[model samples]
Target: MIKNLLFDFGDVFINLDKKAPEQALAKMGIRTIDEEMTTWHNTYEKGLITSDQLIENYLKKFPQLTALSFQQAWNSIILDFPQERLDWIIELAKSKKYRLLLLSNTNDLHIEQVIKNMGAVRYSQFQNCFERFYLSQQINLRKPDLEIYDFVLRKDDLLANETLFIDDTILNTAAASSMGIHTWHLEPGFEDVTQLFEVKKALF
Candidate 1:
């Protein structure tokens, strides 16, 4: 039986438009999200570079840029947060049948927007759904990298077989599976996972 559930926040729970970056940047004369975006994001997610460095890199490339512009541009992917999902997650958390943990490859900017978009109360309610929450920027480790999974499993003394990891990215799912953690891929537009997994009884 699965005694723990590891959730990914971005696309799995809240909606994320993967195509938004290209669309948003296109308006700023950035024809494509190429090396600059890829390199900056990888470095930032790996905790190898600071948020400021990322802003400066882009700002230098486009002289007419402000912090707010960067914030909006970078956070274009995070769409709406559905109330039903929040309610479902909270119900599952209250069930106490399984340990709930959140693991996401995220940066400070993304989190700041979430707090702003969902108000303090809603954001707190969302966070309360997890026994523990892990963000790549804060933790200095990211998914698809073995160390992050190891960090969660070893630090929590959690057995891989007892945990179910959920992520929208196949790479992350594969990484967890390599270590024996069962995984579910939340496909784009697949809003509800109630029928997908045997969730906590409380969510019923």
Candidate 2:
């Protein structure tokens, strides 16, 4: 039986424009996201580098852009958190059917944007619904890495077989599945998190 529900924040619950950041960067004259940029982004998400350091790196590389502009472009990926999804999660939490945990691969700047867009009260309500809310930057762990999945399972003393992890990225879900955890790689347009029970009925 699925006793724990592990959910990803982006695309699963909150809406995200996956291509927005790159598009925004393109507008700033940085047309393609190179390997160096990807490394820096991953490092930031893993909390290995501070936000200041990240901005510094970018500013150093593309001297044409200001810190404010770079930050704005970076944060453009975050969109909005829908009300119905929040309501569903809140109701699900109240039901006490499973231990709800939120695990997201996100950095500080993006999280700040999420809070600003969601408003403090709504964000708090959504957070309150989860037993443990884990952010990649805060936890020093990012998805698609086996260590992260191991860390979560060990920290919570959760059994892989009894926990269901839902994420938008196939790489993340595949990593979790490799460790014996059940996962649903939810498609953004076709699949919504509110349909969890119906979609994965057999697991429930």
Candidate 3:
């Protein structure tokens, strides 16, 4: 009865090292990421602040760090997009069994790195599989916020009961589930999106 499928881009499709950014920044003398830093990150994710502004803010704090170095640290979290997951989504799109959508809490820099890592051609192919692609930076909305979920459901005219949201983060999944949307909080190493059918068989 699941008529629509909403997927989180990071771990569900592409692999991400969530700690890489923090580790990368630590090397640049940002040993402790304070509340202000986290707030800036959230603001940046919501598109309230531009990447240049973020860089400038960080530069004001750490004048010694170069823009290129800061950019690399900021983008270190993005990793590979597995071909099998891409193939699975493409095949699923061909079936037309459900309305496919991609909802990612991502910023411009990360997205740039993602495209660079996947290659433009392959990234385009992956994007072609989705009916709509919502990136947090572009939409100015982020996950774990009810508004983002509501926006997608309302805009798509999708029934929460008939939609399945797949994400790697429990907080995100829990938020969606509270709104009556089914979710698969896929664990990174143990769960592969290519095995969606076998894994979330109850939803199908």
| C-alpha local distance difference test of each model | 0.83, 0.95, 0.93
Per-candidate TM-score against the hidden true structure: 0.91, 0.98, 0.98
Poorly placed runs, candidate 3 (over 4 Å): none
lDDT of 3 by residue, 40-76 (tens): 9999999999999999999999997889999999888
Candidate 2 displacement at residue 66 in angstroms: 0.7
- Superposed by TM-score, candidate 3 places the C-alpha of residue 150 at a distance from the truth, in angstroms, of 0.4
Could you give candidate 1's per-residue lDDT for residues 7-66 as a string of tens digits?
Answer: 999877788887886777778777766776787898898778888898988898877767
Model 2 per-residue lDDT tens digits across residues 147-197: 999999999999999999999999999999999999999999999999999
Q: Which residue ranges in model 1 land beyond 4 Å of their true spot?
A: 198-204
Looking at candidate 3, what is the lDDT of residue 134? 98
Candidate 2 ranges beyond 4 A from true positions: none
Worst 10 residues of 2 by lDDT: 20-29
RMSD of every prediction: 2.7, 0.7, 0.7
Better of 1 and 3 by TM-score: 3
Clash total of candidate 1: 0
